[model samples]
Target chain A: MATHEEITGSLQAFGEGYQKNKKLKIMNKDWDRVILIKAADVDSQHTLILKNGELTVTEGTPAGDPDLVVTADSETLADLFYGDITPTEPYMNGTLVIKGSEDDIVRLDFISLMIWGE
Target chain B: MKRVVSVSLGSSGRDHKVQVELLGEQFEIERLGMDGDFDRALAKLQELDGQVDAIGLGGIDVYVYAGNKKYAFKDGLKLMETVKKTPVVDGSGLKNTLERETVNYLLRETNYLNKDTRVLMVSAVDRFGMAQAFTTAGCDVTFGDLIFAAGIPYPIKTLEELEEMAGKLLPEMTKLPFHMLYPTGKKQESRDEEKAKKYAQYYRDADVIAGDFHFIKRYLPDNLNGQIIITNTTTAADVEFLRQSGASRLVTTTPVFEGRSFGTNVMEGVLVALLGKPWEEVTPEDYMDLIERLEFKPRIIDMAS
Candidate 1:
């Protein structure tokens, strides 16, 4: 029910909130990873970049090898931002799937938990 | 309009209504919290049994699931047998389905707590769904159910310790009345400052504190400057309380309405009423479908406290 731009904008806003947070937790400064979220329904892409302990959301690839790639429908991605559905069920059922190394998958998922706090 | 009511023995003497409109059909959700008075709450349930469209059993869960196992409470079963009316669900069924989704949502969507996160779970036995999710996420989870819930000190180091304690505690927990577990009000906590002060260290030591709001609130330090709290069932005043205590970020597992996040039983009642299906006939898939369509996402409040 949401557009790719809307999802991108929402993540950006969430990143801004994290930055403003004085006592919030962030991925350690030493760790940085670029994640590509592919919305197969709309055939659009948004990148979530975490570098130097700060997070940013931008449209399309940001000139870096993404450590993780998540593919799912637009509604599923929208619901993820809205804090409802988890990628596990979709990933398990093959409605939504992810491509990444074991460490990236685990670490990125942990980061996702931190961002949304579901 | 469909009418749904919740009966609870551990409501701590609170009662109210929550309204949710699904597909343009209005639903009235009423919660009757009898504090420690189970008899009164049971009486209320009997009065509304067949009259109401659905009934929600609050406070104590009917079944607690852990890994591939489930343990049902004897007292909860008795209440169900007596009701014998319209669909009566404890919300545990939906909780089992939704809480896992919630954990996975956090795991794959947000960057909240990591494996190194020190989580102090007040009563993992009561909400096994959360317990399993936290452990699966690889957090350094500590179970404080014995100390926090039962007012007995039992330091839990591993998930094994938690399982052992849950096996023993969950049974006896439902037998006793609510007052034995929790004091009546915040002021009552002053009666045991020594105990409260001791718990402040646990609150201070943990990076990411996770548990029920009541348990966390019972032991919160005067300040929580950089703490991230993961809990449910909170009121607006509780939010102010956390803000005053310096909670850096707060997220309730359930949606906050009016000034509080409601009990799962209330949410389940809403779902049952909306589905308009017999409780026994509904499945996890049905709940998931209704949840996604409803998009009843948990609330994330912006705190200034």
Candidate 2:
């Protein structure tokens, strides 16, 4: 079992990596939006704001017009950034939930694509 | 670390050996392609049986799924019967599991498939898992199985439309020897570049292009800007080709390792070895579990700026 802070740190690192990735940045040019992610059981939350081809992560779920709202477990969310999980089967099987525009979902997964190269 | 080897009927040029790290473990993956020589493929399978950690038959499927029933191919079944000491599975096992996950990954998590998305599958039968996933995801699905695989040269709009043809088509086709129906192994290595160009219209019309990599590569035009390809199997060189040709994104259902995404059977053999299960004991669900645990996403090339 991972602590909420540990998962949050992983998310922060993911944002930093996504910001520094040139190939992923090229894919994310049309993907500027704010994304809210909440872990289902731990009450850990983070906001990923994407603009000007850069991604910044803020602690807690700040109230704003987010482009996407992603909800999953602390493990799943953390594992996702760690490059060991794909959200597709989880999303299809009802383990992961997303409330956002279709394009935003694509942007979020594109980050995973960059990390795992898949 | 685990060792997995495949006996492939495809050409020798495609034979490869590589190491990959997955599921918190290391794997040495080796494949021997016989260049469309069934005698050699079986002989190699015979020699390697019980020697390697796991065995796989590549470049062809063992079974076809329609509804809930599965139809097994004769050559594949015979080969499976020969391997007594080691577990062996045709590529179908991983195709049934990974291809579906890969397509759904793109459809639900990516903007590639929505109501308005136009999808063209070069040979849906070659990757039926992907074809069904796209339809289930509610995209307007097109099946080129008859056109590409059966040589009918015309695309059908729905699974229902293709199902109508499968009953008459597969029974007779499956009865014949495997290679007679379609080029397998090394036979696939060569292409009729001009003939391949005829299907350019299908490639041009779709926003999302999905299918078996061989079929996709056969018909894909040189220009594919903004097009999203969802398929299984790809080489690193293949990726460079798509990138240079202006493809926006390339999504290979199998995960990339050592500069190439592998055949479905090879991935399945890895799972069987990891789970310590006999070839027959491992169900498709088990295959799905290994993929889920590994968190292996489809290899993607997102050169779309």
Model 2: clashing residue pairs?
A: A118-B299, B10-B185, B10-B186, B11-B35, B11-B185, B11-B186
CA error at residue A13 for candidate 1, angstroms: 65
Write one digit per residue (lDDT tens) for candidate 1, span B164-246: 54553443444433444544333222434555676777777777777666667767767775777877767676777777788
Residue-wise C-alpha lDDT for candidate 1, range A1-118, written one tens digit per residue: 5787777765665667567643233323545778888888786798888777777788887597888888888887877765465444465467777788644554444444444542
Q: Any idea what lDDT model 1 has?
A: 0.68
Assess every candidate by TM-score: 0.65, 0.68
Interface RMSD of each: 15.6, 17.1
Candidate 1: chain B TM-score equals 0.87
The per-model lDDT (C-alpha) reads 0.68, 0.73
lDDT of 2 by residue, A56-105 (tens): 88888767677788888888888876656666556656678889754345
**Candidate 1: stretches off by over 4 Å:** A1-118, B11-13, B168-174, B177-179, B182-192
Q: Positional deviation of B163 in candidate 2, in angstroms? A: 2.0
As a whole number from 0 to 100, the lDDT of residue B300 in candidate 1 is 55
| Model 2: residue A47 alpha-carbon error in angstroms | 74
**RMSD after CA superposition, every candidate:** 21.0, 21.7
Across B97-154, the per-residue lDDT of candidate 2 in tens digits comes to: 7888877777667667787578888776656777788888888777777556644345
